[model samples]
Target: MKNTSAVILFAAMLASLVSCKTGGKALLPNVSGKAGEVAVVIDKENWEGSLGTEVKGLLARDCEYLPQREPLYSLVNVSPSAFADLFKYHRNIVMFNIAPDVEKQEIVYRTDVWAKTQCLIQINASCADSASVLLERNGENIAEAIEQAERNRVIINTLQYEETKLGDEIAKMIGGRIHIPVGYNFKKVTDNFIWIADEKQYSTQGIFVYRCPAEDEDPFTLEKIVARRNEVLKNNVPGMFENTYMTTSEYVVPGVRFLKYKGRDFVETRGLWEVKNDFMGGPFVSHSFYSKDGKEIIVLEAWVYAAKFDKRQFMRQTESFLYSFEWDKE
Candidate 1:
């Protein structure tokens, strides 16, 4: 594998130079491999040891808020000498380099190194133990980098195929920016609540936008948020059956996370929603924050229902639309 990769590298570099001469522009090939996959570049010996265990635990942990157990990332081992050509262009990669002369261990995060929008995390250490320590200390930060990169691609695609008329209404209503991708239409629109959905033969993807007076002193508490969500859905969202309304599922406890993105702070809540007196359920994620005027709390929620298929990527694709939050107040 090593020898073959080296030969492929020589040919790839030559092709790159030739492409540059043709248009006076160096166009990189689009990123390869499936989403949620990471290529771990290490030597055979080190990959079988404790350091590899730590790397897998960080990157391969199960994604949260899903109905079934699915790893956050599927890892493919690419030994040091075999990391060339095609494998070098994977969407996500974590590479380890240990040298005798290296005095300190450092973890570096890089993007678009060999492919556009690709995320590469490199760990430089003097030995395997040093690498393990670094991974333990910066695991969350590293995992977040990969996660952001994956979502960024989705957001980029969503921008190209947005729903303009719907965006205009959403902007006028909330005085802010959020992308509503194609294939969605307003299912219900009211003064304080809006429901948009894309219902298909085998799946259902929906988004809910809500605005309410910031009356509660502690508005972001778990109890307050869940209660508000249940109330809103109960009044607005209903099932196909008579007397059925949507509500938060209590079988599994709902969760909330306070995090920041692009200098904006918001609380993210995740849980399952089921219809009252009916047999319909799926996962939902919402981002809540105070509006610009500080007079109302705005919530953006996405949910997925694909009974016969995997929900991980489906939920991921829909939830990414919420992150395109830019205050469009004029």
Candidate 2:
């Protein structure tokens, strides 16, 4: 009897240990340096088109432009939205490289832009020993050179800002502020998640909005989007819910059904879905929306699972989010 009791205790302890372990660790690919390189290529292409002759003229007037390997200004068409997408979705910095030569692999300029709009610049002359030596030996005024490069970046960013502001204004015209039903507050959580609620309002209606500018593709149509949402609901958690399409005067939205919670409506609408799978189990949501004017799309999405919590409580939370939904008026 003593031996049997000891054995049982050991088994219980082992089971407890196993239960405590958390699963779902993900190994993401390293794409850190790619954005900056991409940005440089884009900038070169754009400058080449817009002011290639003029810039070459300027370089000839100020700095030496060698036919063999000269540093000529050019611009590459980079989707502003794509740059934003990199920052918003990947949480990676978009860097610009202005290396003098392709073979050198030395970066002349490096800047990290958040949401493809905010910029942080870093330049190093040591990457290229030849260039560094030449600059140092000649005493070619490093401070002035660095200042000029930074000034160029400022000009680029200023142009980008003007474009973004215009886009925002257009978006506001399309989707006038929907107004978060009275009595709710926006609560921002760590790592970009937000909770929408009011003290008294119950019902799972909160919405989460994420900006992914790198996704420059056209927004998915209502039909295609609804289908994708249904696919997620069907495959991720089986037999617990059904998905259907809800049509409004302006748009068709996707909704999920809860078998556990009868007579509750769970609908979600967005212009784009920026899904991240390994973050909170699977298929975390990110969405964008455009105004009726068709200038900009506002995106709202959420990740809380109603299946994990009590049906009534989940419904209440959902309602609170939905009721609190609002859009910028201007």
* Highest lDDT model number: 1
Clash number for candidate 1:
0
Tell me the tens digit of each residue's lDDT in model 2 across 85-170: 34222212222222333244332322222222212222223223433343344323323333333333333433443323322332
In terms of TM-score, the best-performing candidate is 1
Q: Which ten residues in a row have the lowest lDDT in candidate 1?
A: 16-25
Query: Candidate 1, 135: how far from true, in Å?
Result: 0.9
Tens-place lDDT digits, model 1, residues 98-126: 76556667997877666778887878787
- Off-target runs (Cα >4 Å) in candidate 2 are 1-206, 211-218, 222-288, 306-308, 316-320, 323-330
Q: What clash count goes with each model?
A: 0, 49
Whole-model Cα lDDT per candidate? 0.84, 0.32
Candidate 2 shows a clash count of: 49
